[model samples]
Target: MTTDPQILVQAICTLACYSYLIKENFAYRIAEYTLVALYTSYQITRLFHSFIKPYWQNYAIGEKQYYFILMGALGLLLYTRYAPPQYRWLARYPIALSVGWGLGGAIARSPRPVFTQLMDVMRPLNTANNVLFFVFFMAVMSYFFFTTGKESKFIQGSGRLGRYIMMIGFGTAFGNTVQGRISLFLNRLSFLLTDWLGISI
Candidate 1:
């Protein structure tokens, strides 16, 4: 048993939300709204501390750089969402800047994965795992080979093997996801039964 009032309150909120599973009423609605409000408040506080405050302190007040001022002005322009129509064109500039910057970053990072996969496949086949990996990799990759096509027996067989491997991989992934959900449900039940109700198994 624990003596923390915060944990007790949290457990109560959890039970309140879970009450909907039995039947929906005021308690569940209150609990749902309370969670949304708390989350919004927490996010606002986090962003203020992590980003807004730091940016203001370093760029807005201390350094007073032209870049920061431009950036800050552009960011503020996003609030033009509520402004009249003539000034709405100002909003597009910031949207374009953010989208262009994000796309440039994604383009810069695109080659790393391809290069890594290439390097992995080119590793020496000194061990059993390496040999098997190379074989399976080639088998899977046969699905993408366009020149010879699947007219050849070898290509068809390899593609079939690759399909089976992919199916097995997908099934395993689905099973793991179900297991994870069950684990979460059990954990919540444990919190309700043991922590709140003080019932030991």
Candidate 2:
């Protein structure tokens, strides 16, 4: 049997990765360790370049001395994971600030796209599509009602219809998830075959 060099290299790498399925051995361990080391090195380099250097240059040397102090405080707060229970409260300040800023940013932008845009799409009072949409909306809302007090027959029927709607939504979500996993697998395979093994597609 004849074998091309590139194809042979690709086959070897694929086998090395898949070997873990049979048993844990040297090849799988080497591949796993290499990936972890590479990822760690990449993250360290990125953190230095993205956060440390820029802040040191722009804030440490520039007029933004407050930012430098804030950064130092935040860094110190992160180390509080090793500190005692009473000192742990210091970490909450930065965490709360981060969450509050994030929430404020999201709230500022949410009304236009999520609320106003949806409201703008509402049709006039006399269209069939609008009537059907209102029915669907009411049905979906009925399904979420936890206080099962005196519900009308229509509301109960609407809740049943909502269950079918949710089933279709869930099926679509599952199918999309499967497709995403397959795509990620194919991406890794392409990297191993083409880049690492120098095999043409």
Candidate 3:
């Protein structure tokens, strides 16, 4: 096997991680702590490069955007949560502002995709799949209707069908997730046995 320094370190770390599969021990704990440290360092570096530096460059040098200063003050209000009890109420201001801003942004961007989906649902039922989709959409909408319980036969049937459709969708998603994880595990095993150990198979 070619003893490349980077590959050797990576293989050691991978082996340390896989040791957890046998039983969690010192090697696994060391690997976990190493990964956490690396992740935290990467996150701090990203925050500096992506957000803090950009905002600083914009507000401090080029654009001189005064509202950015206000934004900073609003963000600082979060620290009031640790202040004296009387001043802790100031924390709610930032929370309220962020929540309201997020809500409005979500509402603003939601209509277009919703309309696209509505158009898709209301499109021509030329094929069997289209017909099934139409029935499923209507049934699911019926399931969400809060006014009527399953008292009426029509509502009962639609709601039950909707529940079954939802289960099918969930089951399909879960199955794909399991298949993907299995593939990942097999790929890692191949890396260990073939790449690191240089075993011909």
Task: Pick the lDDT winner.
Answer: 3
lDDT for each residue of candidate 2 in 60-119, tens digit (9 for 90 to 100): 877668878766778679678679988888887778878999999888987777777568
What lDDT score belongs to each candidate, Candidate 1 first? 0.86, 0.78, 0.89
Q: Where is the poorest 10-residue window by lDDT in model 3?
A: 144-153
Candidate 2: residue 39 Cα off by (Å): 3.5
How many steric overlaps are in each model, in order? 0, 0, 0
> RMSD of each candidate?
3.0, 4.5, 2.4
For TM-score, the strongest prediction is 3
Model 3 lDDT per residue over 1-201, tens place: 748887788789988999999999999999999999999999999999999889878775679887887888888999999999999999999899999999999999989899998998986889999999999999988888767855687887898899899989899999999999999988888887878888866
TM-score of each: 0.79, 0.69, 0.84
Which pairs clash inside model 3?
Answer: none
Question: Residue 41's C-alpha lDDT in candidate 1?
Answer: 100
Which residue pairs show collisions in model 1? none
Per-residue lDDT of model 1, residues 40-117, tens digit only: 999999999999889888877888766887788899999897899989888998999999999998899988999998
lDDT for model 2, please: 0.78
